[model samples]
Target: MLHRCNEQLQQFSHVNKKALDQYVNFTEQREELQKRQAELDAGDEKIKELISVLDQRKDESIERTFKGVARHFREVFSELVQGGHGHLVMMKKKDGEPADDDDEDGPREADMEGRVEKYIGVSFTGQGETQSMKQLSGGQKTVVALTLIFAIQRCDPAPFYLFDEIDAALDPQYRTAVGNMIRRLADTSNTQFITTTFRPELVKVADQIYGVTHKNRVSRVNVVSRDDALDFIEHDQSYNAE
Candidate 1:
């Protein structure tokens, strides 16, 4: 009985040692988990900060681009319409309506910062008219559209441009201005303009010209000289007059 009791006591001691080791291992794991949690929290905070800064920079870039394009639009419109004025408007909205900051439920500060960029819009006023684009005549709309295109191109120029019947709806005065502007751009900038027009204004300023002839079901395109292009324009004008 004495030997049996000693063996039982030894077994109990071994069990107690194992339990102690397990407790230590659990404690270490808890500490490691807590450290990792802290690191993850810090990383999350850093990511949020970076995102905030990126948003700010993006807003600033947008504001700058809008302002620049607006200024260019104003100048181009004046030139195209001859005494016309134009500008861009920032339409900040709250729930799809115009924002009013005085309201208690107005947009937050962050929303305001981004709203200008997100809701930037254009307001066009044609020659001797104090109306919006929707109220402008078809000819006026064409001129305004062209002005806007040129304004945007000034902000971000391309290597080449293709315009199809851009002067079709334009008045003679506006067409002349557009042709002059295209010539000026071609002379000053290292860009090419490919335009199709039945008016003599564009043909007169063109470096190269092409003529398209369609007979029955067959169509043919051929390069033509400046005088030939002008003759074609004259013939088209006469046909339209009849």
Candidate 2:
């Protein structure tokens, strides 16, 4: 009986020791998990802060670019059309987003703030009259559009530009101004201009001239002298008039 009692006590002592070791190990693991969770929480906050700073920089860059483009547009317009004024206006969306069936009461203020889409409205003043883009004459509209393009180019110039009949709708004076502008740009910058124009204003300023002739529905492009190109354009104009 004494031996059996000694065996029972030993078994109980072993079980209790095993349980105590397990409890200590579980406590250590819990503490480690808590430490990892804290680190993760801190990292998450840092990431959020970085994201916020990036968003702010994005907005600032957009605002600066828009202003630069607008200023260039005005200057280019004035250059193209003497005694004229032009400006660009930024228009916010009224409803924040496009219409959807799921949105019954339109977008909320927070939704509107999140939207980045915007419209540019052009205001042009020429010949003592201010007009919206929709109200301008076709020729006037063409000038305004080209002015805007030139303005953007001033902000961010490309290596080259290809314009087809850019002055086709312009008056003779406007065409002369535009041609001079192109000439000055070419002389001052590394950018190249490849334009197809029927007017002599542009042809006279050409560094090289090419004549395209269509015969029997086959077109041929060949390098020609500046004089030859001008003569061809004049002949074509006369033919069209006839």
Taking all chains together, each candidate's TM-score versus the true structure is: 0.74, 0.69
Question: After superposing candidate 1, which stretches have Cα over 4 Å from the reference?
Answer: 1-27, 94-117, 125-132, 215-219
Score each candidate by Cα lDDT: 0.77, 0.77
lDDT of 1 by residue, 118-165 (tens): 654545444444466778778878887888789888989999999999
Could you give candidate 2's per-residue lDDT for residues 1-242 as a string of tens digits?
99999988887774565787899999999999999999999999999877766655554565567667777877898898788776665444563332222212222223213324443333455555556678878898889889888888898999999999998988989989999999999888788999999989899888999888899999999999988888888998999999
Candidate with maximal TM-score: 1
lDDT of 2 at 84: 76
lDDT of model number 1? 0.77
lDDT of 1 at 188: 89
TM-score computed on alpha carbons, candidate 1:
0.74
Query: Which pairs of residues collide in candidate 1?
Result: none
User: What is the TM-score of candidate 2?
Assistant: 0.69
